[model samples]
Target: MTLETDDRAEAQPTARPSRLARVRAGLPRTGLAALCGALLALSFPSFGIWPLSIVAVTGLALLTYRRTLKQAAWTGIVFGGVFMFWLLIWIDVIGYDAWVLLALAEAAFVMLMAMGQAAVSRLPAWPLWTACLWVTQEWARDRVPLGGLPWGRLAFANTSSPFTPLAALGGAPLVTFAVALSGALLAAAILALRARGRRAGVACAAGAVALGVVGYAVPLPTGGDTAGGPASAEIALIQGNVPHAGMDFLGRPMQVLGNHVAATEALMAKVGEGKLPQPQLVIWPENSSDVDPYVTPEAYQLIDGAAKQAGVPILVGALVDGPDATHVMNEGIVWDPKTGPGAHYTKQHLVPFGEYVPFRSFLSQYISELKRVAVDFSPGDKTGVLQVGPAKIGDVICFEVAYDGIVRDAVTKGGRVIVIQTNNATYEHTDQPDQQFAMSRLRAVEHGRSVVIAATSGISAVIAPNGSVIERTQLATQAELEANVPLRDGLTLADRVGATPEWALALLGLAACGFAVWQRRRQPK
Candidate 1:
């Protein structure tokens, strides 16, 4: 009887061992997903290992392959949470809680994206669907609760990569699609290879290589006079160092304003001595004058003096008290040497919570930090295409550069050049400056116009139409950059198409997800 029982036990399968194996299998995927997130973060500026972005995307595609909805969602959380936490670590300067909450909220979008990715993984041309989903996620995230934060985009990582020229074709969305598609194709190649499908693997691999190198074939006008005429403008960018680094970088009431005035005066002095060519217009960074020039006489006098000294128009970024007592305006004012503050562009996209609290009456009761922003900032009704001197330039203030619509509006509305006025004193010495600068480079190529960035506490640059840096300033330095940038009136295909590619690609992704669900339902139980 004992021998018979032993024989039966030996023949029976062990349920515990099988369950253990399943659990062990899940751990590696989770670990790898986390690693993928970290790698993606490193692909961004400061760390800037561009190829890592493609690798991370490939790993994510493989992780979600054949995964259940629940499994895919969990993998996304692991990946997105890790990625955002590291990418926005600079937010910790505000508060650790704020950083965590923002990271969690951003990761939620990625979690949903992962669910869609998993759903579509079974479809034919799954790699294409996956790439579209990436664009869809960015589209949603770019405009949502509080004008969604558009940081950590895949296109931003490829600003200087071979895929950069693709920006001129369909803007940032197309570049993102190319990168994501390449990574997905790599994943497909890997899967086929492991399955011993040599022909399929080779085909997928070739497809990825083709996508990666095809950008070089695209024509990008980086030469003189992109407008088909001998038209160019001499521009100057001013980087006025702050008194100190942090939220209080402005220091004394007129300290920040004085720094900018001093820098402008120094540049003018150089021009006076014939050390440099006279600029047609000079661009100052956002918050170069924290106090409203209209409300404060001292600030007005200082700015007026600097503009007159330059003997040209100075695009000065300032906080102007306005529309109401409770609201302020962040504006880029054209201060001509003859006429003080002629035309101005009010910043359209205001930074939520930083510029204004969303639910002041309710949230302020719980979070006392909201008290710091005593007054709210109002949004502008029009695009920032203003005539500065002889050039019609588009002015995007600080974080506004990250928004595709804002930047595209300027170009489509007859902006000859692009100007980015930023103040990075609060986030100085962090990856934020480098990331913003990368966006400027991409914008140059996207619109086929010269991009001039003026940043307080540094990273001022002059970017060519082809995304080359003609001049750049270091962080926390008081410096001036002069460049003869070409004036391009003709818009790229991206400018003409606007958000069509993004919307179409996003819709396709959603359709794939729906079809995937329908397919699963049609299957037998």
Candidate 2:
């Protein structure tokens, strides 16, 4: 242990590192980590597919390939940062600068997962840390800031993947967990294949693949529409195709309402001429009449006239002020041919900055140039279930369908059918319609309820209870799509049990993670 001996030790590499370690050490560093985040965000779009995901997971694996907990955390933040930065692009244009808070919040949640993987690996048998962390992160994202934003959960990418059967088993959270687990397992196998215990790694990777295969193979609940009495109900969705500027409807309320009315009239004429079947319910997009129906007599008459002409129970989207004058309720009024404004379902879930500002007065300056839409609509109550004679129509106005719990609660409490009363005028040309359309599809599957999307601008659809897009309208089209949406009398296993499965899995994964952490701490150092 002389100074000369120590100098010699420092000069000579102790033992030339193995090839696998050499590969890890010799890997070049680049801003590829940031690119991984971008591609991962892009994966949220339709046809994003597995290739982008492989790039993301591989990049994530590289981020952790040879890093410590601190380094992993920094890299994970980089991963989350590029991700949220891209995810929030709509938020900035849609102007909830407050979304910066949500992005930061979610990035921190991802860091927790990074820490979980970094700290818990010293144990003999480790749980899928990446998978567990991913599920937990999704749950967290959808839980924070007024019950959470369930928008960018990983399972969203698997909407079209065969792994969708996992949704029926435990909703999208389970699917997300399986996908991430498989990807991480694959990455581990690649690393392990180049090392000593490659066989076990291959087996682990195989097990993950088996879970995915089994997910696809399993038969999900089909207690939906079948050979039942009066199984189908005809419904029509009117896509008004309003301008990208949200309040454009108010300027041309006549044209907006005229567009929908003209479309409905033509559709019903087709039904009369035996060209198309009659719809029991004719639906219009949110803000098809943003004129205050409750407070304005003239407005109610206008809507009532339209409903009478349509010859069906109509759902009219309108802006109405509350009784107290302190707030306004973004609402959809149920109007019958005989009675006008029969029953009303108000929007429960409020947009953080869009419909109503979080700190309304303070943040008005940022979005003032685009019309005062953020302050126009009022927050609706959850108990607002539309009473359509013997049938119950569960309605979610604007962005409420984006929330799993909101839609679930509606169906659980007595809503047999779900309607998305959305005004997509704020996001006309972007990928918002497709993203929102995918969300409705996932909800249809998760809740065992049919969904009718009445988008103001375009991409309105009729989605069955099992996530199938039964029919949909083309983008930026002024038209109505009529479909016999099979009415589901029963709820899904997920609707009945709520997030019970997710919570149980989370606890189990967390316990395994905690145990792994404990064993790691106690290991001989």
Candidate 3:
């Protein structure tokens, strides 16, 4: 058991370790850090998200075995920095300077989380301290400097893991805790392996195995799990490749529509040629139909004809002028083959510099391309569900999949299938799709709902509730994905709690830090 130290004493600087000693204690090996990140990325994309996370976190913890709080922080920071630098390579597609700054901020946030954990090194329960520190940092990063960037989040590790069911309990937070704890136990096992006592090794092995066992016992329930009944509905995702991925192509609405028009015609030809299966509902990605369908009669007629020809419903990612003229909604409109148009869901979350500039009047003048390209499209009410065939679908436009609670609530409102229609054409990120794909997989685990992702320029896919990719198109290409989606009915415990994992960790971490500071303050001079 560890006794809390005085805050004053805790603040005092002690004699620092020599460079070689620090190295031995895992004080940031540039090579190892970079290698760890690459491994993490590699294990993902194909191997699933767990092994990489388990290895990365466990390795970091071992690196800090005999190190001080400061040195431990360095280890975590270096590891996180390298991971984000590669993981977020797509950001470079938009621009260099701004994204680089964003990466720095993101890395700093992760490092701070690590530092917080390091500060609690003397705690009796090191694993618990590590968890608290990590949780604390996650919350801070979510709120700091404007809103927050929740990219490269830890919960993504279990996206393909058997432990994915845990997301239903507390969203990503539960997953993060379990994964970290698994890593912590692994670190303990490593320590036990080197120990002279066989009992210690046995205990560590038992603990690690217990974590895995517990994860397995807590089975996840998919939204489809509680579905009133089971039936398959055919769906289509349209990929309208943009002229180019450059921001310079903005204001060219005609060109944007033209690209989509060409693609839709090709898809129709496939249907006639019997090259593609008949779809019950056709899904177009965000901005795939940015021109208001209500106003663009020809576009509406074109889509209507296709839907009638296919004899199905079509959920189109479109732009809608606000009712009061105060804003224009980045909207998702449901157009039935017979009904023309019915319900709609607007995009609630907006991307900075991409969708619209922050404080367009002030920030707009700073980023020249942003002024020309990024529109002042307002967020839509996501509460509304689009009627598709016999199913009521929720539309998660673009990166909205990144927001956990929002998607959960949609499912709560009886959203049978969550469809994300997005255009990744602007950011020709080679790795961006992989990162985005990873997040979507986790979403499947959390909500237990089938997800249909349609992206312009490639990587359009259909994901099953188990977080497995069913089918996907190649990148930088135009293709049509036609698949049957299962209707989802029930909500998980996590669906109700919404990202509780990071929140719980952040709260406890803060309390621990406060306690540590208090103890140090009370220490004698």
lDDT agreement with native, every candidate = 0.90, 0.69, 0.69
- Best-fitting candidate, scored by lDDT: 1
Q: How would you encode candidate 1's per-residue C-alpha lDDT over 1-525 as one tens digit per residue?
A: 010112245457776668677778678778989999999999999988999999999989988876778989999999999999999998877667778888999999999999998889889999999999999999998898789998988999999999999999999999999999999999999988987899999999999999999999999987555453447889999888898887678898888889889998899889889999999999999999999999899999999999988889999999999898889999999998887988899999998878898889987886667677789999898999988888889899999999999999998997889999999898997898999899999999999999999999888999999999999999888999999988888889999899999999999999999999999888655
Tens-place lDDT per residue, model 2, 1-525, is 010112234446578789798556433332566777777888886445544664576567645653456756766787778887677656655555555766787777766666666554433444376667677767777777766777777777777666666776677777777777777677667656656577877797787678668866655433345432345577888886654454344455556766677777777788889988767888888878766776667667777777787778888887777745667777778889896777787787777656655655655666563345534456565655676543476888766777667777787877777888887766665566677787777777777778888987777888877677778887767777888776666766767778886776666667766876676467554
RMSD (Å) per prediction: 5.1, 5.6, 4.4
Error of 3 at 490 (Å): 1.9
**In candidate 1, residue 498 scores what lDDT?**
90
After superposition, the stretches of candidate 1 with alpha carbons farther than 4 Å from their true spots are 1-25, 224-230
Off by over 4 Å in 3: 1-50, 63-76, 192-198, 218-230, 248-252, 255-277, 322-327, 359-369, 523-525
- TM accuracy, model 3: 0.85
In model 2, pairs of residues that clash are 142-148, 328-378
CA displacement after TM-score superposition, residue 320 of candidate 2 (Å): 1.2
Error in Å for residue 282 of model 1: 0.8
TM-score on alpha carbons, each prediction: 0.95, 0.87, 0.85
Cα displacement (angstroms), candidate 2, residue 251, comes to 3.3
In angstroms, how far off is 409's CA in candidate 3?
A: 0.9
Query: Model 3 over residues 257-315: C-alpha lDDT tens digits?
Result: 55665676777789889988777778877777657778878767776775676677777
